[model samples]
Target chain A: MAQRTPLFEQHQAAGARIVDFAGWEMPVRYGSQIDEHHAVRRDAGMFDVSHMTVVDLAGDRVREYLQYLLANDVGRLRTAGKALYTCMLNEDGGVIDDLIVYFLDDTHYRVVVNAATRDKDLAWIGEHAKVFGVGVTERDDLAMIAVQGPQARERAVGCLPPAIADAARDLKPFSAAAHGEVFVGRTGYTGEDGFEIILPGDDAPALWQALSAAGVTPCGLGARDTLRLEAGLNLYGQDMDESTSPLESGLGWTIAWEPVDRDFIGRQALEQQKADGAPYRFTGLLLEGRGVLRAHQTVITVDGEEGEITSGTFSPTLERSIALARVPVGTGERCEVEIRGRRLPVRCVRPPFVRNGEIKINLD
Target chain B: MSDIPGDLRYTKSHEWVRQDDDDRVTVGITDHAQGALGELVYVELPEVGMELSAGDACAVVESVKAASDVYAPLEGVVVEVNDALADRPELVNEQPYDDGWIMRLEQVDEDELAGLLDADTYLETLEDE
Candidate 1:
């Protein structure tokens, strides 16, 4: 059976373009996708990201279990309401899922995992929690809404209860705070300043509607992908998977190597990969010619090494084709992409074609 | 908008062709095709002076969500392609009938053109679907 979010009826009221994504019914777009994309970049926009799974871990050993489970050190989240972004890996160093773990208290921590990877992530965390005595409870009663942009916080903070507005207003990036029963986190995937508000599932529709009335454009998954790609964020299935490791997937920085003695899942495999050095690196591409770069297209390197484009699109902000590809580590600034048997030249740069409403790579 | 134009002929694959005064023909995807695709982002057209046979793949229209092929209505030499498409692919979505015509054929068989559907017939086929 297809699952519906708390805002399902509200989406129907707005004439949204609906599609089935990962076995869940989702809105692909409300109206013009480009308009929503720009709204988040310039003004404010809201997204119904309630389909993502939220798990709350509670007990005496909760922090200890996360330290053992995540690749990034969770000890850095010393203060309450601090959020940490990290990847949980399997025994072979392949990423299980990249997620955000928030420490609400010493005994209460919240972890939000990808909707598609929820089952595996829960089992992995459960396995580690067995020894630590941590209780992992899925928060099905909660639904999340992300209001993101320069004005996102202003609009969303006003819609919530008065108690939350104060603390939520002061939330630093990568932080979360609870006021009453609402959990407002200063985090977002759109590379814009915003909040991900977690509230009771029954109250989500009313809140989503309130924000709609406030002139914050309601965006969908289509705009979300473009926004995250423009911000240089990696999608799990395309950018990395179980067979791929953090070192080669441009996620090495997310791995905490400090203290060197810390043994997280897949640390041994990552150490071996580090000693071997990276043979190929993930890169960003800007098409010099006319054509949209798309996934699975072959990227031609000067050294004749084959690289595959993981994610590509015609960037609305840049008005040119941009893509992320895994190429030979030495593959430098210039390359060609095969589009319909024609090898079109492109410029390769560091990952992330755009950031914070600014074009990171020069097109002209 | 009117189902199909009376003066033009249509292929079963949804291409519309108009015969010119000099035996040349202008071929383009039907308006229905563009509306279904929704927001074209890229176009891959066949080269000028390329030989094509009837029902041969002539061009590719790529929307953001999917890609579709354009087939030749009649066999001929490709005299020219819509060069504007290379820079402005969304023209296919915005102006699919006129400026968005995919290609022009230098020589086309009249017999092949005669077998295609007339305006009324094409509109009836659309209504059935």
Candidate 2:
């Protein structure tokens, strides 16, 4: 049996096809996934992302603790409500999880981690937190919904309290605000303009229905996966995990190297890898031939060095297959992906295939 | 419940076969199969002249989520492949039994078709799953 969200019955009412994802029974789609994917790109779409874990850190040493725990320095979040995306890495430099931490204040901050990595992430945070005596509280009493796309903010705000709605409307990108019992973050994984709202768990069903009534299409995890892939956002376990380092996984920019003495975890190993020349270069692959590109497919460069695709999918926005792969450094513009024993040609390029309702990379 | 045509025959792998004539049979995935796979993005159909043995994995169906193999139910020579799926693969999701027909196989043994499950038996198998 799998765990369910507060809006599970609402999902069933909307005719969703449920699937087991990360030990939770979640809606994969309400109808056609491709249509739902397009809805998010073209207009407003909402997703029940309540399964993601939210942890609040409170203590005078919270900032110092986070500076030691994460690859990206939370010290950059100078203003309240500002959010930073970062990686939690193991001592040897392998990525434990990629998450967003919102700075509410010096002593109170909130962090959201992936659902699949919830258990380990909490354990790791708990273990490291004891040294700082930071209070780590899981926010299971809340539920989250992400309304995304061009008209997402306006529609989502209409469903919130007037004060919270006004605060949400004034939010900048990567910012969060709390009014009364509601917390709204102007952050999302879909590479679109949106708001991720966290409210009381009991209010989820009513909010879901309200969003639907406001013409926000109810999207599911299927569309979420494709949208994030098109946005070049990495999926936690698929794109990177405990075995891969941030440098090789296209997450080097998230590491803050300035104030070099901060001595964050995995800093030494990452610095050493940087000094030694990273072995693999993470890049995007566009299939020039027919057939879908999928994870675990081998990519062979022109010079014969091989790499593996971390995440691959048919981009509904581009109408072609795209993937993120880590190939040997110096691998050139072209490579071949082995799909079912057939080597199909592909072009190597920068990621972010689409962003802000526009194509970021040249399809031609 | 998925629509299972009584006149058609089904393989345990979720393919449905309809006898177009004495030796030629039209094949497509069952409605249950397409529903499970979700909206398809691409289909790799066998060439019209390709020869296939029973249970041979000849075609491939690629959905947005993943790719699945489409196997041959009996020995036959491919007579026709659904060309429309090359451009519009969602036909398999929208109309799996009609326009979504995957291929036509000629020279199949009519006697072997009896070994395949009928609509009722196929529904029972689906329930067991």
Candidate 3:
């Protein structure tokens, strides 16, 4: 049996197609997935992301512990409610998981991690915190909802209480605010302005109804995947895993190498890789032909060197197929993708095919 | 509930078949098939004059989530393919029976059409699944 989120009943009422995802029964789509994808790009749409694991760290040494545990520098998050996106790496420089850490205060911090990696992430954090005397508490009692789009903030404010709404209105991107039991963060996976709200599980259904009434479409994981892919965001367990390092996963910018003394877990291995030229290159691919791009497809360069697609999908915003590929360090502007035994030409571009409800890439 | 036309024959794989007066047979995915697959973004059809056997995978329909293979209902030679679907694959989702017909088959086995399930039988097959 799979676990159900607090919003499962609401999903059923809205005629969603439920599927098992990472041991949880989750909604994949309500009706037309393309329509749901467009909803987030053009207007407000909400997704129940309650399945993600939320853990709170508390202690006098919380910041120090996180600095040693994560690859990115959490010390940069100076203000309260400021959030930082970072990757937790194993000692061998392999990515354990990618997460967002929120600095609530000196003694309190929150981290949200992927659902599939919950067990390992919690165990790893617990083992490391023992030396720092920090307390790790998993917040299973909470539910999360992300409302995203160009009009997302305006419509989402209509459903929140007055104080949180007011604070949320002025919240900067990558910042969060709390009111009573609800926590609102101006962050999202889709490349648009939005809020991610975390509240008590019991209060989820009513809030979902209110948001739906405010004309925020109830989207599902299908739309979420497409939207994030179009935004050039990475999905854990697909694009990277414990076998891959951040240096080759298009996440090198997240690593903090300054303050030579900051001995994060993967520092030695990462420094060694950086000293040598990184062997792999991560880039984006735009299909120049009619077929749809899919993961694991072989990409052959003009020199006959090979690469593979890490993530691929049909971009609802662009109405064309696109992908992210890991190729040799010098793979150039043009390559051919083998789809159905035919080699079709593809153009390489910097990612983020669409953003803020507009096409960011030149199709021509 | 899906729309299963009473006049057509259906395969267990969810394709509908119709026999024309010229002894040719037209085939397309059923309404239930299109609804389950969601909005199709691309369709790959076998070319005209291609030979197919009963139960052969003749076409491919790709939705945003995944791709599904459309099986041939009866053995025949492809006489014509729906060229409009190359640009507008959503036609299969909007009208799976009429404008969405994927291909017309010539040299079809008439006995094979009789073996397919009727509307009532096809609905029962769906219910069992």
Candidate 4:
């Protein structure tokens, strides 16, 4: 049986199109996916992301353990409420999951991981945490909602408790602070300024209603997927997995290579792969024709190198199709992707095809 | 559930055909089919002069989640295809019966239409499955 979020009835009340995603019954879209996508880009939109799992690491050695466990060094989190985005790796130096970790205090830090990888991430953390002696507790008592866009922060402050409303108003990007039972973070997957609110599951519905009344549109997984894709954010299973290393998944920048002496898990394999040079590199494709790019379609460069698209979609802001593909490293500025036996020309460039409600690509 | 008008004829593949007095048959996906496919995104209509076999894929409908092929119900010539859907595909999701009609064919082999199901028969077929 599929699990439901605390705001399941709230989604139903909005006439949402609900579907089973990663074993959880959640809204894929409410009314129109395109409208919801435009809402996040133009104004404000909120999503019930309570299906994601949050783990709190509490102990004297919590920071030490995170530094060793995550590919990105968390040592830079000197101030409380700072958040770090990193990928947890397996022995093969492949991404087990991409997650966000928030440093709350010297002894306490919180990590939010993908819902599909919750069980494995927990077991892996438990098995490897013995040396540091940190206690890992999953926060099932909490539900998370992400309110994102240019106007997101202002609207979300109205729903927050008065004690933390000032703090929330002043919070910068990639920061988190708590007021009473609510934990609000100024972080989001979309390339928009927003806050992720974590509160008791019992208060989720009322807070959702309040936020909606404040002009925050209720978005769903459908809009979330397009927004993240347009922002160049990687999905755990689709972009990279246990077998696909981050070195080839456009995530090499996320890894901390300095202080090579620190033997993080999968360091040796990543080092070797890096030294050998990656054959297939992740690239962004801007479609130049009428056809929309899609995953698993064959891509052939002008020089005859073969590649494949990992994720693709129509960008609402760009008014065109964009795709992410693993292509031969040094594949030049122009490439071609085959759609239904028709070869369509595409341009290769860094992603963020649309950001901050504006088009980054010259769609001429 | 949206009502599938009794005057219309349906195929097992969930397409509805309305025969006019001029002998041109207007075609659209049944309301049930549109309900099964969530919000329609992109649509590919057939060419106006194309000759189609009974089971040939004449058009394509895409939703945000997935894509589906709309097969031709009977052998016919594509007399007209909906140009409005090129820019506004959501018509299939909102008005699958009237404004959302996909195409109209002039020369349909009426003999092959017997294999298609009536409103009650199609509902019964849906129930048996």
In the predicted model 2, the residue pairs found to clash are none
For the candidates in turn, chain A alone yields TM-scores of: 0.98, 0.99, 0.99, 0.98
In model 4, the runs with Cα more than 4 Å from the true position are B21-24, B35-39, B48-51, B121-129
Rank order by DockQ, top first?
2, 3, 1, 4
Show where candidate 1 strays beyond 4 Å: B1-15, B18-24, B109-129
Residues B2-39, candidate 2, lDDT per residue (tens digit)? 99999999999999999999999999999999999998
Ranking by lDDT: 2, 3, 4, 1
Summarize candidate 1's per-residue lDDT along B1-129 as a digit string, tens digits.
Answer: 534677899977889998984568999988888766667778888989999998898799876555688999888899989989888887876776789889999878888888888988888787887
Winner by lDDT: 2
lDDT of 3 by residue, B16-122 (tens): 99998455899999999999888899999998999999999989999888889999999999999999999999999999999999999999877888898999999
Candidate 4 local lDDT, A1-364, one digit each (tens): 9999999999998888789988999999887787899899989999999999999899999888998999998887888999999999998998999999999999999999999999999999888888899999999889999999999998999888899999999998899989777999999999888999999999999999999999999998988988988998888998899988998899998899987777788888999999999899998899986556778898898889899998887776776788888999879989899976679899997887778887776676
Using Cα atoms, each model's DockQ against the true complex is 0.43, 0.89, 0.77, 0.42
Query: DockQ: which is higher, 3 or 4?
Result: 3
Rank order (by TM-score, best first): 2, 3, 4, 1
Error of 2 at A125 (Å): 0.3
Which candidate ranks first by TM-score, i.e. highest?
2
TM-score of each: 0.92, 0.98, 0.97, 0.94
